[model samples]
Target: MGDKLSLPLKPFRSRGGVKAPHRKHTAECESVVMPPPSEVLICMSQHIGVPCKPVVKPGDEVKVGQIVGDNDAFLSVPMHSSVSGRVKKIETVTMPNGSKVQAVRIESDGQMTPFEGIKPPKIETRDDFIKAVRDSGVVGLGGAGFPVHVKIGVERDKVDTLIINAAECEPYITADNREALENSWGVVSGIKAVMELMEIDRAIIGIENNKPNAIKVLNEVCREANRDMHGNVCVLPLKARYPQGAEKVLIKVCTGRVVPEGKLPADVGCVVMNIASIAFVSSYLKTGMPLVTKRITVDGSAVNRPQNVIVPIGTRIKDIIEFCGGYKCRPEKIIFGGPMMGLALPDDEMPLLKQNNAVLAFSEKEAARLEPSDCIRCGRCAAACPMGLTPPLISGLVAKGDAEGLADNGIMVCMECGCCAFACPANRPIVQNMRMGKSIVRSAKKK
Candidate 1:
């Protein structure tokens, strides 16, 4: 379900994750537009593919939605300026992945001016739709950051069903929920547009049963659609479970289809897009604006105001914290997403990326770490893993440097969803070991 899973493997546990607490603190707080950050650091490598090269040099005045970084790579999408300002400088910055890429620092003029070149795309054909999607800079808004255009640009016959993922199962994240409630029409219009352009058979919008309001709003919108816009789209309420929002997990639960390892949803006659991503498509098609802002939930024990804020891309985490009434206490950990699979940034200086759905800051007590104890071999980790892989086995292989065994056991298939770590009474760092084991297997392959 995660990007780390690539190897083909045997059947996995259809349901093998923990029922984590749904810390939907800001579920009812409608999203508010955050004032533009004094400065923004737009990264060149926002998506999963090749990093975009800078198209604007320092001292150039650019407006919102202006193309600032771009690459010709099919897997890549253009990066646009989130604010109207002068490019202060272009500097090589370290990304969370430990790689360095050029980052454009822009001094926002506070006017929130738009680029004159912003325009709605003409979409008469499927190619036009795909191109428009790419031009809109839409990616996986659910935190995958994969280029949406490249994913749905396959043959018309390849995808039979289009799945809209409205299941925001992760804790402390309600951006999708807000989108469903506020932009129900946008979500439905997006689905209708995609289905028409791609010639897909039907569309299913999956929302967890936990959010009855979101589900109800979506169903009402779909039900009240004009007669010509009816029946092709429907809503399905799913059991709320952690990692239920994972692409493959949602697909299986919604369609009873298991995307084989090393394959994509398209291989199984399906395409999955995040709820917010598709809603943005409808908005972009009308406004011609690229994805320059994001609606993110800001919460945790350390935050003063726990609510959703629509922020410009590249706004620093510190600024966002300030906007959210600042910290109630000194944060020991600042995560860029949900606690389960979110990344803990080194500091608040980091800029928000395209896929960041939530910013969670926890105090030392809330973020406390427990020392790992000897495994009791109770198999909780094994039972908790969605892939049914043995976490202890992987950890042992990583410790013994047995890359062969790790690879044979589908080490790469570990999505690092952290279910094992969460379920382990021993507090074992199984996900960390999986990351290490994956590195060893990668090294072995390269050797």
Candidate 2:
């Protein structure tokens, strides 16, 4: 596969994605509102970097947008409450990965008052601009909640391109696309704000071709904005592909650059931000608003309705479902994220944090369980792997507990996109094994 022969090949079927029943009818039809929960658990280590230090002790009353956790570490960002509440306790809880970590527990007062320090700052200098982004505690809402300040404050000379990911590639995950369409002007304004803050002139918005309406709105907004928008903002239409929204894949498809193995996109003179993140930037810069709320797709097959919701962060999943007219059938499982990559929650009590983009409830029939069968040794997993690594080999080593072999086979590069798991005819839990393999390899490396 020469670069010339394979580079332009867009053979991927845009709609070949497996359809888990959509249980989102009740929720998606209505505008988003705050789903009141009795308690909210705020995680200190929600961001990728160091855990934030708790700013308030137990018995302290806190308002929404109040920074409950702050750290002096440059890599860490502060955590704010999504509701006005009394500090219940700071204790450890099991995260999605099944590891227990310290979390600040708050019992809601139901007042939902804004925090006193939620006002936005006047953006003047680049330093001031960066500070505003950091103070708001904004992260990538697409999925991975990487800190936003790190990108804004990056070495100016190292970055040459800014990529806005409007590619909501996952099926049923229309949060980003909807945000881009509804807030097109905001998206343009946000990017311009980023350009002013970073002094970078070249920015591109990469949207999947499936989202024609969003693409049109973005272009229209860019044309209307008079900030020398010519040639600076380019909307690249990517061929719709599962996992095409992955940072590296989007970077490759949009900019034709391969982020070198174990290297950040900044190393290749690029920084990628989600459309929602850009919207947040606009909100903070224009309205002086903190990141107190965001839009989410509250959908799945077991609901009476399906709709996107503008939800306050930290709302419990149960309340979200109830607000959507409750379950249509006995929801056997509730998953967060899209059907391809979302994690099945043990219970519906998990708080909707910055990282969660969708709250999916599925009936027993919708939550189809596949029995693991013998591997046919087919290379379909390899062909479907966007990273160009063989998943079967990784799964093999994982089955044999060959952590070293898994590492040698490039297990770390797997993004856990669930493409292999979705493609497997043998019904193997390829993604889970790859995740385990990556973890074991990481543990071994740490030693």
Candidate 3:
């Protein structure tokens, strides 16, 4: 009972998800420092909302943490230069989401000079706290890229619980796990700060039981703090399940509250944040460093050296792979994030963004797709869907171009966690179909 305590709370379970391979080759590897690249392609539209406008033009000199792009939109965050460099040009690049975004190209001077204005933000109130968070350019580093200030700026009275998602539930992505282990103090401090700012009394850090080390470290950190001063910051070990880190599922598991469809966690008196996002809050408050670099887990069957690496934002994927000892074999596919919901890259030239937690390179053997046979009607897809939607039926409707029918079947609610596809014996692309169905529904709504 020195540091660990076995709470009597039951482990929450979602409706369905497959027990895929963890393949966490770099779970034990401490994150290595990646050298800055010769050039960077910082995208202006890295976050979820409106794309930022470039404040600096070509030939303009910039320093690390200098705001290069910004937007007045409340839903957006500023983009900063990760390296001291001169602006090469601004060009259009296709993001993994298949949308074209403007990217500022910078030729690195290799000095890594911090902006002169960099200093800890003064925050005496909630508005100041939110301003500091926004100024730091923090976002959902767990791959969502949602602006953090906008997420936590909700009405304090509306949120009773704050859930820290430490459940690196996806296989092979250990960035979050490493953050929880090495940055335990930052994580805990961030939680306390958020609690004080938001007036939240209850906070839970949800880590999968598989990460016993991280769970232990976080719990120890919390235990060392004054419980009376910090309120309740509990590190709860969750069941190891796919999509366990999804906001809806996490809220359900951690608080035993269902985030209804067409609503948010705030609507249900909860706020969810990624572990890295929380840690960034603590780091930013101390150093005033914006979200310019990211911790990425570079691993897969084709990776020569599977390890976690901290890289500056806008570093090319090719450089990251090379820094990890290059590929042992040619990768047939490279994905950003985890196998469950990662976006497959058409090439490795894409630059890393703030939300990129992992870059996985898969060899042909691992990336090979199995020929999908006719549906066996085994109901495995339905059994594995966490949303309780019937994947097979929705997939059929999507194949038939029945957008209205797909909408009627709740296809838009699909998180595309790939649980159904992984559990399918027939190798059906249930998640892909669900994505198509969602797109179809969106188009229908637009029309």
Candidate 4:
């Protein structure tokens, strides 16, 4: 196993990403728990794939960890109640992604009662492991919302590397960093658990150089646990760059493996999981508490306190902001997640989803609309794309409604990290057009 540790530390390079301002205001703030909101709005479609159907009706009593909605689809996972409450209603609500999803509204009884069936799973086989993961209700906590059970259930022989993504590279988000520093044991345990269950011997925890404290803490934990004795559990420091935490980018930086176009990390002998997601695995295996609460960084120019807080899942954005001391100035734009990849919310009424990591409130000055101009053709957008995409060309095709041309140029490969738009001198909405191009391709394929 010690021999497996021989993989050399790869040089950290820019890799076409920009040097955006980190603005990690809450990096030093320890997370504090926020009281449960008076009510919760748990959306059934939090995970990718088919939306769950409500299992409990409007007058039903629910306990924490009780499954409220579920679906039999192979790609879907169940939703659990975050608080002991009575179901108020089940209705359709609009999400930040512009999709209307069925959400279960629960009026809290103020008593956090655990479900009677909440107990640690007895995992003696691979099937048991998968079932436990599904029951835990874990997903990609870094904002992707892909079901974790489906990811780990990939054929074992094809996966040789497990990458723990701790590179919270997005600006204004520090939830993953704080988790790495404070829950080092849980992080290592989670990594080991996956490695053993999947029969993988090599694992890498990738943290950006910006988070020196997290890197140092994780390394120390690995050494104490002797994780390197049985398998390679190395902490690889990444160059501090925007979109550095992207799955494809992180795989390339950590394992020197390039995920081919229209493929997944598993297709290249790797599986990437967020650090916080792995930590939750460690916690759930011990306490049997499902994914019900989340640690989120509440910050931005308009936030009054701007701190990291732990709140129940389905907690409304308005309640969380109020807990953070409300707005210092009237917020002009509210974003869920980091500025680079987060979705802008029309209002603060939306409840926090399983994938949400931060809620950024920008004042009018910070959220000032920038006028777009003709492309300068300066090539900055291409140079700044971490995926090495020519945004100007793809965006032009999208504007002309040339979905076929966009697909020929690999438009679907764009992760829409907003680097191209951020680097454009003319302030063009390159990512927005790229998104439109992708939607066109997807809708055509579906048809």
Best by TM-score: 4
Number of colliding residue pairs in each model: 0, 16, 0, 0
Tens-digit lDDT track of model 4 for 159-272: 888899999999989999999988899998998888888887688888889999888899899877664546378889888988889999998888777899999889998889
- Per-residue CA lDDT of candidate 2, range 321-416, in tens? 777778899899888887777888999877777867888888889787989999898876777788877887777788787878886788887888
Q: If both were scored by lDDT, which would come out higher, candidate 2 or candidate 3?
A: 3
What is the per-residue lDDT of model 1 for residues 186-272, given as tens digits with 9 covering 90 to 100?
998898898888887778888888899998999898877635654667788877777778888888877778888778899998899
TM-score per model over all chains:
0.95, 0.90, 0.96, 0.97
TM-score, ranked from best to worst: 4, 3, 1, 2
| Cα lDDT listed for each candidate | 0.88, 0.77, 0.88, 0.89
What TM-score, to 2 decimals, does candidate 1 have? 0.95
* Model 1 clashing residue pairs (backbone): none
By TM-score, the better pick of 2 and 4 is 4
Best by lDDT: 4
Residue 323 alpha-carbon offset, candidate 4, angstroms: 0.8
